[model samples]
Target chain A: MNALAARRRHPAAIAILLLLGLVAVGGAYSLLAPKQAQASVVSAGDINTGKSLFLANCATCHGMNAQGSAAGPTLVGVGAASVDFQVGTGRMPLAAPNVQAQRQDTSQFTQEQIANMAAWVASLAPGPAIPGAQYTSGQNADVAQGGEIFRINCAQCHNYAGSGGALSRGKYAPSLTGSSGKTIYEAMLTGPQSMPVFSDSNISAQNKNNIIAYLKTTQTEQQVGGMTLGNLGPVSEGMFIWIFGLGLMLGCAFWLGQKAA
Target chain B: MTDLDTTGQPSTDVVHLDEGHHIGTGGLPARFEDPGLPTHIHRMADDSPDAGRRAERQVVALFGLSMLATLVFIVAYFAIDKSVGIFLPGIGSTNALNVVLGVTMGISLFGIGAGAVHWAKTLMPDTEVVEERHPQASDAATRSAAVGIILGGGEQAQLGRRPMIKYALGGALGLFALPFVVQVAGSLGNPTKALAGLRSNLWDIAPGVSPIRLMRDPEMTPIKASDVTIGSVFHVMPETLKDSQHVLEDKGKAAVILMRLDPNQFSAAAGGQRAQAWGYQGIIAYSKICTHVGCPVGLYEQQTHHLLCPCHQSTYDATNNMEVIFGPAKRALPQLKITVDDAGYLVAPEGFHEPVGPSFWER
Candidate 1:
């Protein structure tokens, strides 16, 4: 209203007020620097939050303490590897129990939430975390040893030929022929289907790497004298040997006798 | 004067014979009746006294050869170490003991046969007799007579009383069976069945320990939450399985498959339902071990959301409380309630609701 009052409320005063505001913010930041000033590294202490979320959503089956109750397994030491593989891909909080926990879209938990949960789980049983999308451990796996182990432990189900096999009911052992190392690693880590969990306690990470190496070797070396027929196994192999090899020999013998005569 | 001139030329080769008798030179077949073959023959042994003695020797020799062959067969059975690979040059077969036993046995048998043939042809009484072939089935009289012949032969041999040769032959026969006995009883010592089974088991539900992880076979790495995608299938286990600590082996049965699904589509497990706490938002887990035979029920169909077992084709409907959807499995796979721990990893909230793998009769 008055000319003098208007002049006093000028742009300079506004600029000075802005400068004070900036200084106050800078001072506050400096005071709290050690405790609150970290980079965008998001290793939040969200495990407590995750634990609560787990009890609310997962405890019904998993139990309140995550110790496992009726209709669930004991989660004493499954590790972050299992947690990440299960929830990261939305296989956890399964739609329902099937031949296996089928992988689907629409994860219920966010990546961050899942991470928090993984951290908590890892605390219980510290072990291998989820493998990266491409697990490229260039260590050469011993194919012969792998084959022997495969035959001894996995052949009955996955098939000696790696063609995979059926399980009781409608379940089946999956084929390892084309699975990427990541997929294989995740599958082992998560135990997504009717598969049981294999903690690092069960199979060492090095052993897993060796197995992957062997798989790679086999994927390349599968070619042999023709007509594998999915290698349905010894019975089929025997059938082929008898039908082709022995049959030809018999025919030759018969021809020879006739010619001699 | 007439007889004196001819009498000087008396018979040069003449042998007297009885009424129905004949003589043979037992020389080359060219001089014999049938000239095709010059068979092994006996000379004066074809007649009386000396002939009988020769016949006895030949018969005894044949039996003795048979005994020797059988003995050799037994020796060959035991002589070859099983680890040695057999190589046969003359024949295609290559089993060491088989070849050696077979050759020795053939030689012994051949000697026995030759000895017997020599005895029968040269020394057995030479009288021509004929018997008529009749019906396929022998009459009672014929059968009895045959029995009588056998009995008569045995009696003539004085087998029971003589004891020495009889006992020796018996002992030889008994010894011939020794190899088979050794094969059966001796081989029983090595039982690989139990060992092989333990070597390849999928579940290890023991007691008082952490338990082995239910790891995916081949690549047996432990699982984490982030790796599983919705509609993804996983074969899982505990991390404890890889540990060297013996105690973890006890609770291997606790392995479970944790999965998440859309909660609305999921069906609660059947059988007098209690609290609807078997699953989470959609996450549900079950034992990988089959409830029937212990094959891992790992085949998962994402669209159908079904778990299929390879062994007997048992199916588990994940949305329906892990119930038996198909195949020989009598019970549903045991479900395990699972959740993320404070650190954001997958963990079983507790042990399985029921025993894993096969449902025991005791259950």
Candidate 2:
């Protein structure tokens, strides 16, 4: 006790104490931290194939080690979900460097190939994984609650109907009409392009499923009011009334005012 | 008729001609004669008895059709279910009840109108007639009498003789509007008091009290620092809002958008350092009300780090202390200085230094 009290005044004592404290915290955190669920299991062979494919296709923009270059951002910690959303949606391996990447109808890679790349990216660092089927499926979701959540969080950018809207500098929030349940989940998890992330911590898995269910219900629901005018809301409806409705009235007036033959 | 001179004055030289005289003899007609209406053309209903009978039958049929349509409308209104969906050829899906009600009502009205029109055009008189228009102004004697009556009424009131009463009445009538003006203006409230109210919001922590927790909007759940991840955005409100007298008004002023980004991503040239210092780690909070026109600036683009107001497209760089990068926003969004509490939940240690929302006169 006398030696310890004397050493406490030493110059290196504070540094030693801080280092010991950091080590203890790190060890405790590793043991106590919640485990990240692995949505899919990837083999050693899958990682090797993904590495080879990435080298041949992506090494030009991204460095051989997937480090960022002047042309592209680094994919070090951008998880498997990001890769799946980007590659699976055919938004990456970009056609050209524009304001934003456009989603293509068909992807360049198969599901297995995309999975392999996701595995390789996941191995690089701790990041979000592809969501499991239980969370991705919209079954047993509360559409009404999901609608409230969507309006608060998503309606500002994506529009009230999820029909997409324009952003600044040629960017846009894409429509969620035909997006698959898996794609929707991954997009929320990854936050591709201009979209902000809605991680599991921010929006729970069940809430996300509810949102998916609501979106799906919108696609299938009958438009009871007849013509939707492209579902672009009041602006389009107003313009239609101004043009067609007024034009028809004007035509009728002209016909009515004409002298009988 | 007299001819006008080039100077627009009536000339003394004038010539009048008889009714049958031609203008070739150098005489002007005294007046223009009115042209009579054209020869009447008779319709089949007017000339033939069978055609008249047929027209009468057609009118009766239209009236009968109107009665039938009214009956249909009443029956359909009671029979059709409100929830039943019907397919329209051009309009697609629609409510069966609405369509039926609208169509039946339209047909019933149309039948009556058409019946009345057909009865008038075919069976009733189709002859054209003219009626002369009378002069709009009153005669000089009548106008003079009206003016005299008004002047006599004014004299009877003693308005001219009683100077004191005249001026007093005038002043009373003129000043009578003051109360109304004052009431209306007072109802608008004091602008300075309103501006003072705007200066503080739900985030303002009272002295000697603990800092306010940042709760998730709508859900009102308390947020933890760990819950916010990189590129994730959260709609937040101060926990003090639970006790607010005017929840909507307080919420409008205190609503915030919280976002986390990579600390290194903040640009040094745009007040990014100060923004980072005010935040806890990379999680920063800013007033959601737009600096332009008080719109909710809710569109947060993660990669571009831009917060675009859906109204007016006022874009703010979220990483650069909410600096206006594009559109008409005049100033940066006010940042809320935040810190983590002992329980690791995000809390606002202090309210915004500047008034939030759009610029007002006092600001």
Highest TM-score against the true fold, candidate: 2
Off by over 4 Å in 1: A1-161, A164-212, A219-230, A245-261, B1-228, B238-255, B268-276, B339-345, B359-362
Residue range with the least summed lDDT across 10 consecutive positions in model 2 chain B: B1-10
Residue lDDT tens for model 1, B79-98: 88744544334332245665
lDDT string for model 2 (B188-291, tens) is 99988887898988888778789999998777889999999889999998898898899989989999999998999987864999999999899999999998
lDDT of 2 by residue, A184-231 (tens): 999989888889999988888999999898888776565667666656
lDDT of each: 0.62, 0.86
**Displacement of the residue B217 alpha carbon in candidate 2, Å:** 1.3
What residue pairs clash in candidate 2, if any at all?
Answer: none
